[model samples]
Target: MNEQLEFVVRAAAIGTGATAVMDLWGLFLKRTLAIPPLDYAWVGRWIGHFPRGRFAHANIAQAPRIRGETPVGWVAHYTIGIVFAALLMAVWGLDWARDPTLLPALVVGMSTVVAPFFIMQPAFGAGIAASKTHNPSTARLRGLITHLSFGVGLYAAALFSAHLFPI
Candidate 1:
């Protein structure tokens, strides 16, 4: 396959893998830990509560239910994953996508938690660095673990795809 096509395939694989991992994490958190599934609709309602400060950061737990559309939030979530994968490729090359190491990939993936803690969560009104949650430490830890799993998923998917395609 051409290099461009290869890149696209690898990036998509990474993104899909990350999404799957995240979904599994959500499921486990809900089923095992009794945490509710993250609802983008609720998040939308929360954002809508403050029309003037729609984009401003606040504590999501305290913010009113989201009221507007949810597609933007969902898109942002997946796009972040895709961007992470692309960055990995840029740093380590296409070969890394096929055989991603745990250290670098996990590190990169975990690093992504900062964005949600400081940016998206706050923008959604979660709080700066998870300050709104009753148990911020646990939430932060869960986020880290989940993102690490996503990195592992990316590696596993790349390996499987490589096996299927054989370079």
Candidate 2:
């Protein structure tokens, strides 16, 4: 395989594996922690409403419960993983996929929290940088921890895939 195509393959593999890990994590969190599953479909619906500005800057946390759905949010969540994988490939090349590094990936994932803090949360009415809650600092810290965990997930997935399906 050509270098470029190989890179794409590696990136796709990493992205897929990382997304799977995240999905499993969500399920585990729901089941073990008793955190209600966030209906990703509802998140998607909210995304659909973006064009109309119906959900624009709407406080999602305060929104009345509607089966606890959010398809757009789920889509966004997975898409972010895909995008992050692509970025990792772009910056580090296929070798990174084969021999994933936890630190760099963790840094990248943790840094990504800024987006949800500044953009998504506020748009969904959570408040700027998680300001809506009684303890905004705790919320922000949780988000950072979650994203860092995602980074670890990404690295673990890549390593597992590389071993299971050697390139």
Candidate 3:
């Protein structure tokens, strides 16, 4: 495969794998600790209104439901994962993907917290980093753990890919 095509494929796989790991972690948290997972429908609802210049909501749950909100949110979630993976590749390069390091993946994953802290949470009416939510600390911890898991996922995916396509 061409260099660009290979990179694209690797990035997609890494992101998808990372997202899957995050989802699995979410499921574990939900099942073991009774922690609830994020509502993607709300995310969709928030995004759905962006075209209407309605970025902030007092309560996304109460926001008017939008058509195909669930699908939109899910797609956006996965796409964001891809973007993060691409970011990791951009910073660390294909050599890292082949060798599989932990720090860069973790850093990129943890850095992704900025997205929710500044944009997503605030727009969804949860305040920055879910400050306005029922339990801010708990919410923050959950996010931190989730993001960390995504970082591990990124590394794991890289290792797995390298094994599969060893030079």
Best by lDDT: 3
Model 2 lDDT tens row, 1-167: 67777666766767666767666766777799875444565566557665565765465544544443464566576777778888876777777777778876777677778877887777777788879867899778767766776777778877885786576
- My TM-score estimates for the predictions, one after another, are 0.80, 0.79, 0.96
Per residue, candidate 3 scores C-alpha lDDT tens digits across 1-167 of 77788788889999999998998999998999898889888888888999999999998999999999999999989999988998899889988887888999999989988898889999888999999989999889889989999999999988998898775
After superposition, candidate 3 runs with Cα above 4 Å error? none
Against the reference, the lDDT scores of all candidates come to 0.71, 0.70, 0.90
Least accurate stretch of 10 residues (summed lDDT) in model 2?
A: 60-69
All predictions: root-mean-square deviation over Cα?
A: 3.1, 3.2, 0.9
Off by over 4 Å in 2: 53-55, 61-73, 164-167
* Predicted structure 1, TM vs. truth: 0.80
C-alpha displacement of 61 in model 2, angstroms?
Answer: 6.2
Q: For candidate 1, lDDT tens digit of each residue in 56-144?
A: 64545555544444875566567767878878788889887766676777777777778778876677666777678788897788777
lDDT for position 38 in model 1:
64
Point to the candidate with the largest TM-score.
3
